[model samples]
Target: MNSNSLNNKALHVNLREADMQFFRYNCGGWKAAATLSECYQPDRCGPRRFSFVGGGGKTSAIFKMAEELSDLAVLSRPGAEKRKVLIAPTTKMYLPRDGCVLLSPRLCEVREALAVEPYVVIGQRAALPASAFEPKIEGLPSSFLEEAAMHADVVLAEADGARHMPAKAPAEHEPVLFPGTTDVAAVMGLDCLYRPVREVCHRPELVCRLLGVSPEHLLTPEEAARLLMSEKGQRKDVGTGQEFYVLLNKADGPEQLCLAGEVAKNLESMGCRHIAASSLSPAEG
Candidate 1:
């Protein structure tokens, strides 16, 4: 009925096949999915596995979710020990053993975060560079997907665009050949910041009132440049629902908080879902 209950149900459903297969192969006994679900219920002592993709706010969200679930369970029963929920981050970084693992290229950042406290550590193969050969398949790795399905109670993957830059003006100018006047002039530029549609547009807390067009749907860089140089506007309807967000990433010291607050209010007014915000400062006590 509630979000937590829904999540719990999803967890139970996901674990069914894995638990049954594990028992059938190792214990040499037939175990039903329902039995395994009961064994792994919220109040049980069994370890719960939650696998998640790295990057974005997913890690933070999962951490918050774990804390909430634990608190809810404890509140429901005054004298009960909270169930341990393992939070794992899958990247090309160091791997975690018991608590969580970082599995990709950004190893340093993950290591620093983990070193602040004791946690399970494990490492995986480094991520392949973007310049590597194209995949034979269109989607994600089958092995990765199966592992997520079988081993994880909850898997949160960070979805992002291939290449994105914050909204800002260009720092340099390029020389262009002109037909007449024997003179060269610098061109005015428009700075636009790009972000994943789901992260930006769909987020109620960000206060994004308008939908965004994807890079794939937009005109080519050269075409856009030509239009701008000729003082002609190029408007192409990429249709709605491409899933990306854009914003001016720059704001003054006081303006940042003001903007954030405004966005929050707008989101609330628009009936947006799952909105959250946090501020991190090293100088804070």
Candidate 2:
């Protein structure tokens, strides 16, 4: 099975259940979870790789997903072999504090961690530059990621860096996805709505270029949809048959939620297949 074949691929929640399941992460098989999310749509556990791009709460989504899959698998197959969930990155990121963190690049160590724990965070810790704040975990090599993916039940990779911003526009070499990534979620914050794009977005210059607007342009629902759909935005490096989702984040209040719904409507009109909106805790993206 390929890496893009798991249950919690990425966010695509059903809007009707927004007040309830939206924040609970109660989702499964993308289509059924359509009432919750359009992430991975597998009825049973399968080898699935999820690469999260854009920003918003991607980091939070990944670990929550790891835990969800672990519990779901354990309950679904009592007394069966435990599931393997790997949280790795294709770019620099912080290692998740919850899992059995294996910062080593060696597969033997990864195998060992997997034996002891169902969820593992694999990466190489790198010191930041002098001006930067702290050390961050660098991604594993592509070859290593591919090899590790083969041994894991679910693989979640953070492919783009957003500096914790709500939205972003990838540069020429941004969003580094690993091989066989089945689903990619372009996470953005609904809070960016009505805010100056330059203030709320990462790589605002690129966003300006994509939207043909000035840096001070405020983001609107329709413009947000355009950015989410633009090849220069979330669709960068995405291949056919691989699912792409626009996950609107930070819809914490009714006002924001309403704006998110508007964005969803705009995206639907543009023919975007997978879309979700929710308020997430502060998680890495």
Candidate 3:
């Protein structure tokens, strides 16, 4: 993992693909081999469109998902052909990390690449305002994303930013999703549980609003469930026909995993059908 991968929110993760099986960190990177379950055979079929929102590990989730779907190109069974996946962040994102190829904006070049590569990541170059040149890429416009979606078998897009918080409440303009998105996975970190909103949330005010609390609010597991399920949170702007999923991330230890299970139960009671728990951060000593 890069020095900044874990420090930066929803931007990068350390993942490597090998041996027909993907190797990721114990947290979800290049050391363990766990089910990249993707909440239900995310690899079922293609022309599949997936988008990620929420904070915590959204970026890591996308890369992990890419590791899962790109393998479709390697299947040697009958009718298995080179599969293509396009990772286009509809909101601002860092440039492509390891384990992915960049998608050239040129149509011919893209076509050529698709003829060989299994997956590619696409984003518009973004110029940061404060710093003197940083490597960054903002999301493509909806129209352009739609145009590019035509060539890929699977399209994975990041539709939100959380500045690395494990949880967040979306402002009115947040989470700019692709129009064709078929599934949306919302992630929150268990590490945020019991932490103060001002300390762990990307938009504390919005989260406070949703939780009916103050800046110093310590998020309980129940509050975490409420925030994850609230329309005013990461679920904002999610349209009909799009399946919504909740991922409780960074559940690192026995206690956190136990707490994540509790949150998952509450989410189920609140009518969320798709829920998963994971420790998606690199293991720390």
Candidate 4:
């Protein structure tokens, strides 16, 4: 496969399509081929509301999706009109790495930002190092996110908090997903394999309680996969008929890649039909 072609394809995808053509481009016939045992198409349905949960690359997924959607939004429009992609979180989060950020939740200010930039971040104000301008913008409220949905071409929301951990098990009230979320991508980092649960998993106790394992137990690929596929794992709070997508991220080396395959198998066994394993580095604007 031509690496350049894959990158270009991925860079142009509109998240609303629900067709992972870029995924096919990157994974070749292995993961993307319809004949493959693990293959399943994500539902190409409405709203384009994606709520990213789980650990690992939630932030990376949000930014990457935002970047891709922004490109498509701009390309879909003609002439000087700019289309917008909004990155908000149901929970707290740092500011976006690039683009204009609006602190106010009011719709007028958000519209003004969209007028100037295709990519915009909206949230309340938070105290942070002045140099970290984006982090200072606390995430917007859920109601505002629903309101913003009508205006932006796509809404990518980071619905869970992991406190920067590579893995996690959600608490009872965690993941705060929006009611309109059409797709929920549960992310897991492959690097956490073989590490002690306490060392790798956020909310280690929750992981232990749900998995019925000790916090110090070494995390196996199977165990990690089970955590994400468990009823209380990715399935929690997902509305009826909502789609679930598993993203096994940080498959950066041979060992991690192998583990990612196993995780995919486990997810499929547990009824997660749509899965993608990738090493997503930060995308530059």
Q: List model 4 lDDT by residue over 1-285, tens digit each.
A: 111111121332222333222222132222443321122232243446778888856766676556645553424445634446777777767644445666664677666555556566666655563354334345566677777777775677778777667789888888788648777778777777888889988899988888899978988877877888777886678876777887777766667666777777676676766777666663211
Worst 10 residues of 3 by lDDT: 1-10
Over 109-164, each residue of candidate 1 has an lDDT whose tens digit, in order, gives 33343333222222243355333332110113434433432332222222221122
Alpha-carbon local distance difference test for all models: 0.26, 0.71, 0.68, 0.64
Task: Please rank every candidate by TM-score, starting with the best.
Answer: 2, 3, 4, 1
By the lDDT metric, which is better: model 2 or model 4? Answer: 2
In the range 187-283, model 3's lDDT, one tens digit per residue, is 8878888889999999999888888999998989889888878888877777888888887776666676678777777787787777776665441
Q: Give model 2's clash tally.
A: 16
Q: What is the descending lDDT order?
A: 2, 3, 4, 1
Task: Give the TM-score of each candidate.
Answer: 0.32, 0.83, 0.82, 0.77
Q: In model 2, which regions exceed 4 Å deviation?
A: 1-39, 42-45, 73-81, 127-133
Give the alpha carbon lDDT tens digit for every residue of 1-285 in model 2. 123122232332222223433531222211223222324453344688889898667876676566656654524555766667888888887644344666654787777666657577777766562234444687878898999888887788889888878888998888899678988888888878888988989999999988999888889999998888888888898889687777777767777767877788778787787777665566533
